[model samples]
Structures are given as C-alpha cells and as structure tokens.
Target: MSRKKTNIEKEIRALKKRLAKKQSRKRKVRIVARSVISKSKTVIFDPCAICGVREATTRDHVPPKAIFPQPRPTMITVPACSECNNGASDFDDLFKVYLSMQATGKSEIATRLFKERTVRTLQRNKSLLAKIKAESKSLLVENTEGESEEKLGVLWDSEAHDHVVERTIRGLYYHHSKKVLANDAELKVQWLKSIPEEIESILELLTEQVIGDDQVRYKYYIAPEDPRHSVWLFDFYGAHYTSGYTEPTDS
Candidate 1:
C-alpha cells in the first residue's frame, strides 16, 4: 500500500473506534438517566436526605459521579436539597483525588481520574495546591514489595472528609429506610484504622450486624434497636476502613 494511503486508512480506523466508544457511552448514560427518572418519581415528595430541612430538589449520587466511569449501571442516587447537593462538590473532589492517588497502580479508573481530573484541578488552583502542600506530612508507606518508604502525603482536611461521610451516611439511610433523618440528627465518624483496644468489642458487634451479601467493596449495618444509628464499612481499591455513627439528638 502507498504510504499516504496507509496513513489515511489508519486515521479512518481510529475515527471509527472513537465514534463507536462515544456511542456506547451515550447508550449507557441513557440507561442510567431512565433509571434515575423512574426512581425519582417514587421519592420526589421526600425531604432532603442530608439535612432534612428543605424539600429534596434533586438527586445526588451516593459516591460522587466523578469517581465512576461515565454511565455506570451501578450508580445509585438519593434525594437532596440544592444546598446539600451543591455544597459537596469541593469535598468530593478532594476525597476522589485522595483515593485516586492511593489506588494509582491498582485501578485504571483511579489513574485516569488522577491524571485527567485531579491534575487539572491542581494546576488551575495554585493556591489550593500550596495549601495542600503546606499541610502535608511525611509518612512511611509500604510498597507492593512490602518495603516501607518515607513519603510526603497531603494532610486531608478532616472537615471535608467528615462532610463526605455524613452525606454518604444520609444517602444510605434513605436507601435502606426510605425516610429522611431529622435535621437535628448528629453524625459521629470514627476511622477504623487506629481504634483503641477498648472500642474493639464495639467494632466486633458492628461487624456481626453487617447487612449486605456483597462485602467486597462496601458493607453497612443499621442497629437493630434504632434505625437512626448505623455504620458503614468501605473498601476503596484495597483501602479498607469503616466510618459513620448516628447519635440520637434530644427531642
């Protein structure tokens, strides 16, 4: 084949491949949209799952949409007020970036997210990058080969992490009970990574109450005595941990 002709043929094949992938993504998005529409019809009357103060104006995906490949069939959404929905974006971005960094090699999605989204965000916001760098600390992380190496890891904002956890707990509560928690309901989050020996018994009890058959990625347990008190366990690309606790508020 002539050199120019061969190059033309290659370009045509690449274009066709891109078009096919785009169409496939579109189809998946349509399917998810239909599912959201159908589900929204049933829960439109409910109040915002997060704060429970305002009427639910829209649906918010439990795990922020940015973390998933476009048009994921597993995407689940819950009712949220505009404030609750829009307020989560910054924290979501931070959490996803943290997870992406942690799962860089093990997950292609995480790598792509880090390169395409997180890098761009950091580049655009020099001040934010500076703040993160300023707050960073040195930590010893074990590599796949089991050798510990000192690394500078960003100090994640506790408030941002807590907000994401609180929002997720509210979404899960709605998913399970079809009810909005009271606006005054208090959420206490405890990271399971460094729990004290005294709390080991409580953790064991919570472990036994796990509700889901699928324990690979995520599992949750609602206290049998009171639905308001629940626990969520998450395994994000092998970063396994549990968080979330609902404390009763005075009536």
Candidate 2:
C-alpha cells in the first residue's frame, strides 16, 4: 500500500477503536433510572457504625453531604459517635471535592455541584485548590466524535478515598443488618471504573437503595446465615462506583 493509503487505514482503525471504547464505557456505567422500594432504615442503633465501641450520638452521612449540591437528595446517615464523625470530616471533604471535580456535567446535579458549590469551596480555599490541582492528573480521553481530548481526572487520594469507601460500606452493612460488625472485620474494597455484567446481575439480586437525587445508590446482600459475609456495590454521581466485600477476620 502507498504511504498515504497506509496512514489513512491506520487513522480509520484508530477512529473505530476510540468509538467502540466510548460506547463500551457508556453502556457499562449508565445509571439505572428507576427507584427500588425499600424498608431499610438508618435506625438509631446503640453503637456507632464506625467504632462499634462508642455510643451512637451523631449521625454521619455516608459519602458525606459536602459532595452534594444544595437541596441534596435523600441522605444515608448512620449512627456514629462524635469522634468517628469528627475525625472523618477531612476525608469526607477530600472525597467530596475530588469526586465532584470528576463528575461535573455527568448530571445536572453533578454539574451544579462542580461548577457552583465545589468550585466555590475550592476557590475560597486557594491552598486546597492548589493542592488538588497539583495532585489531579491530565488524562487523554476519547470524545464522542472520535477525537482525543484532554481531561482532568481525580487521582484519588488513596488513604482518604479508601477510608471513605470502607466507611460507607460499613455504614451500609449496619444500615441493612441493623447490627454492627466487629472493629477487626475484614473489608476488601475496590473502586470501580465500570460495572461488569456479572457484578451488575449480582447487584440486581441484592437489596437496592438510592439517595442523593438518584446519583448515589448501592445494592447490598448480607448473608442471612452468615452476618460476617456481606456484599456491597456503591455507585456515585451515577458514574463512579465502588464494590466491596466484608467478613469477620481471624484477628
């Protein structure tokens, strides 16, 4: 083949690859629009979800309220002591700011939170903004029209992000079971880029719950026979997601 023809063929192949990837991502991540009926409650249980050692006093919003825009959707708040509640605020703030940045334009609520609330918060805290910017990554993503585009993606702060996900799962386990897991309970957390069909099917079978204007939802199944083993799937901003499994540890 001539040089020009070969280049043309390469470009065409690249275009096809980009288009397929875009469609796959959309198909994998699209949020379920309908709501599922539920009877689960964030009951004022005796002990805090976080520590299980302290008396429950304050309630902590799983995923935190800071991430949501004004007139936020229904929240999932679990019983928590003042210590666990107060200590995780920093991690919640980190989770909120970074995830909001990543979710802008994914939905009207997300857009508003990103362009208005989150931006304002970051603006007022220039140091935090600078810090986030420093950590944020510039990534190459394919756009709808098969063009490569630059995107600012959150480089999840591992310690903070893991804490948020694990905390959310623990709260959720308590939310469903109305029982507390031991502090040494083992929680294996995974942040998802997209949900696999197998996982989606499993989630569909679990008890589903939604909040945050339908932007945040999770499906969980705690083995009736074994409270120690539980499954959790968390979706945020209708896009970002995390899945986790928890069981009692030997320790």
Clashing pairs in 2: none
**Candidate 1 lDDT over residue span 1-251, tens digit each:** 67765554344333323323322111000001111236457433456777665677899988676554433436668988799899899898877766666556665655666787778888988887889888888999998799999977776666666667667767877777777654444555544442334434334333332222221255555644455545555555554344555534441
Candidate 1 segments whose C-alpha is farther than 4 A from its true place: 1-45, 69-73, 194-216, 240-242
| Model 2 lDDT on a 0 to 1 scale | 0.69
Task: Show model 2 residue runs off by greater than 4 Å.
Answer: 1-45
TM agreement with the true structure for every prediction: 0.68, 0.76
- Error at 41, model 1, angstroms: 24
lDDT (tens digit, per residue) of candidate 2 on 98-172: 788778878999888888777777878899888877887888998889999998876777677778887887787
lDDT of each: 0.58, 0.69
Best by lDDT: 2
Q: In model 1, what are the clashing residue pairs, if there are any? A: none
On the 0 to 100 scale, the lDDT of residue 22 in model 2 is: 30
